[model samples]
Target: MKILANDGIDPIGKKILEDAGFIVDTVHIPQDELINRLNEYDAVTVRSATKLRQALIDACPNIKVIGRGGVGMDNIDVDYARSKGINVVNTPAASSHSVAELVFAHLLNGVRFLYDSNRKMPVEGNSNFGGLKKAYAAGVELQGKVLGVVGFGRIGRETAKIGLALGMKVIYSDLFEGPISLKLNFTAGVEVEVPVEQVELAEIFKQADFISLHVPFTDKPVIGKEEFDLLKDGVGLVNASRGGVIDELALVEALNSGKVSFAGIDVFDNEPTPRQEILTHPKISLTPHIGAATNEAQERIGEELANLLIEGLKK
Candidate 1:
């Protein structure tokens, strides 16, 4: 069988599929060319750069499996594809730690105002060293602060483990009703289990000193003006989940009004071209949606995806 890795798979995964008696193509077929050429393959894999919507799914009758290399199938019409007897799968566990670590990368940058300092230091460091030092001297610490995680899935749990290890109290809100246990592992073979209870969404917003969102994409923004209004003054916020999870306009307003002290945004409402306000905000630390872009995460994702496709194609 032939597989088209539309967004390009790791060489490890490509070799795995080939060794398993399947042909793999890593060429990136442009979006316009997919409908014409995709049906030639038995399976297709993608990351965030490609879309497998209903139209493309309907057009490709030969495709047996639709594999997403990472979590979040917002780019793929999963339910619709499944309804058409096509298997839709994603590697939800593969990139959890990488994404979790990126959340902290942004959070740490925000708390210390590194984003602003890095930008201004290159221009004003020599002339205004003392002034810049005074400007950034009010940075706060993350230890002993309340961290609110808005979802409690794999990535969310990983984030909570880090928060606990950092001496931060972690609270979370999820769709599930029960408390969850997280096991923290150390380099010296030591492990500790911590139990955390789920809190109401409003309560998380009100009590948390730092909030990191981990929910999936929704039709509307989860953290809008009303949610922002419920936050503690000078609260730190991080969004590494999906775009539009937090309202960009409301976030800017909050930052400007001091309702939110600083924000770390990895995802944006618009991809490739986020709003100028969000891009230019001095109080916001930004990354171009690279939450799961780590080499380790890609390796895991590739191995997991290859295994899933191998299993799926045999059915």
Candidate 2:
């Protein structure tokens, strides 16, 4: 069987699939040529960069399976692919830790003003050290604070574990109905099990001191004027999930009104070229969507995708 890793797969994953008697091709095909050559391969794997739309899926009559290296299927037309009996698989667990850590990175960066300090200190350390220190001195502590997790998926669960360890109270709201119980094992051979308390969307909005969004993208943003109004004033927000989940315009308004004290945004509605207002906003902390950019996560994602492809295509 011929498999194409269009956006490039890790060497380890490619070797694993090749050992299983599948011919793996690591070709970076142009978007214009993708549909024309779709029928050439039995399976294709892609990262977030590639877009596997319905037209591409319709053109690929020979495609048996589609593998995603990382989480989030916003780039791919998953429902359309599945409608045509194409198996759409993603390595959701591979990037859980990386994304969870990024949540904390943004949370910590925003609360501590680390991003601003790191930037300004280097340039103005000698001249305005005292001034900068006083400006960023009134930082909030994470301990004893309420952290609201919007989605209780793998990434959200992992983020909650970190929050629990840091002495922050965690409350989550999800589309699914049930109690979530998780057991976390520490490096020293210690395990801590906690039953995560589930709450309503309204409660999360009202109670949380810090809100970190983990839900999927939809036509309407989850965080807007109504949700922001429910939240306590000066609440911090972190969005490492998909873009367009949080309304950027509403967020800017909240920041200006002091409803949202600070925001940490990893994903943007317009990636690579975000709006100038968000980029220049002093209260917003931004990263270029590096949630799953860690080396370990990439390797794990590759291996997981390879296994999924092998299992799926072979059957």
Candidate 3:
């Protein structure tokens, strides 16, 4: 069988599929060209860049399986494809740790003012060292702070584990109805199970000193003006989840009005071309949707994708 990795796969995964007697092509077919060329392959794998919508799926009848390299299948018409007997799969577990770690990368950057300092230091460090020090002296510690997690799935659990390790209190809100225990592992072969409290969505906004969002994309913004009004003054936020989860306009207002102190944002409402206001915000720490772009995550995504495709296509 032939597979087209439209967004490219790691060499390790490519070799794995090749060794399993499948021809894997890593060439990136342009989105416009895919409707004409994609039918030659039995399976196709993609990351966030590619879209396998209903029209593309219906156009290519030979495609037996559609694999997403990471979590969030918003770009794919999963139900319609499944209804047509196409197996749709994603590597949800592979990027959990990487994305979780990035949440902290932003949180830490926000709390310490590193995002602003990094920009200013190169320009004004030598000129006004004492002045810059006075500017950034109000930073707070993460220890003993309340961390509010809006979703409690695989990535949320990993984020909570890190918060517990840092001596912070972790509270979460999810669709599930009960408290759950998470096991934290250390480098010295030590493991401890900690209990995390489940609270209502409004409770998270009221009590949390720092909030990190880990939910899927919805038709409307989850954190809009009304939701922002419920938050504590000067609360910090991080969004490594999908775009449009937090309303960009409301976030800017919150930051400008001091309702929110700072934000660490990975995804954007307008990807590849976010609004100028979000891009130039002084209180925002930005990354270009690289929550799962780490080398380790990509390798795991590739391996998991290869295995799933083998299982899916072999049948």
Candidate 4:
């Protein structure tokens, strides 16, 4: 079996495939260029940087699968891959803790205004504890705050647990009606599950003290200008899902106007990079979609995908 691998995949993953006599080809080229070489390999693997579009899958007839190293398949063309008899497998459970940690980090960063404080802290000078103190000076407490989770997916539910543990009321807003089927018990936590109807998206905006994005919506933006207008004062926003879920232009305006107090962003509409506007925004705590950037996660993803591809090719 021949595999064309993206450079960022786990090293152990590459070694295992290579050692198994699979001709593993690693490249750092862009997706367009990679598409040209796809015909030469039996399988193609990537994380989020490459978009496994319909055209790419159609062009490479010999390919059997496209392995995703992380949970989200937003970057892949699943329907087209299936039509082509290509197996699409991802390591969904591997990055749970890694991404969950990011949510906490971003949450704290947004509440405390860490991004702005860190930038001004002089790296070379002996400026005392000025920056440290300033960073904590504006820090807000999570206790007794209303944390509204937009989706009850793996990450969303996990995040809600943390919120509940922190003495905050956890209200989940999923599309489905009634209570969430997944049950949990917190040693020092309480989750007050609420249906999406209890509070509309607008209510989520206007009432939530802290709002975290956990669902995947790429075609249409869930929150926009009108949504922002309805936002309650001093709301902390966190987008760990696809960036398109929130209208960037609308969010930018809201941030500038102080309508949104803080933001913790991980994903973007565009992958492998971010729009210049968001990077320039100082009020946001931005990560380059490193929610699942961990050694353990990558290894598991690589092994799982490799096995799946091998088995799929045999079938």
lDDT of 4 by residue, 1-315 (tens): 788777466777777776667777777667668667778888887877788888878888988877887778877889879877888877777776577778889888778777877775666225747656755686789998988888776777777767766777777677765354334464578545432323456667767998888888856788887788887888888888787888888888889999988788898867656788888898889998888777776677777767766666667
| lDDT digits (tens) for residues 159-243 of candidate 3 | 9999999989999999887457789999899999988889999999999999999999889887899999999999999999999
Q: lDDT per model, in order?
A: 0.93, 0.90, 0.95, 0.76
Clashing pairs in 2: none
Local lDDT at 250 for model 2: 94
Off by over 4 Å in 2: none
Clashes per candidate, residues 3 or more apart or on different chains: 0, 0, 0, 0
Clashes of 3: 0
Residues 253-273, model 1: lDDT tens digits = 999999999999999988979
The predicted structure with the larger TM-score, 2 or 3, is: 3
Give the local distance difference test score of model 2. Answer: 0.90
In candidate 3, the residue pairs with backbone N, CA or C atoms under 3 Å apart (3 or more residues apart, or in different chains) clash, namely none
- Cα error, candidate 3, residue 91 (Å): 0.8
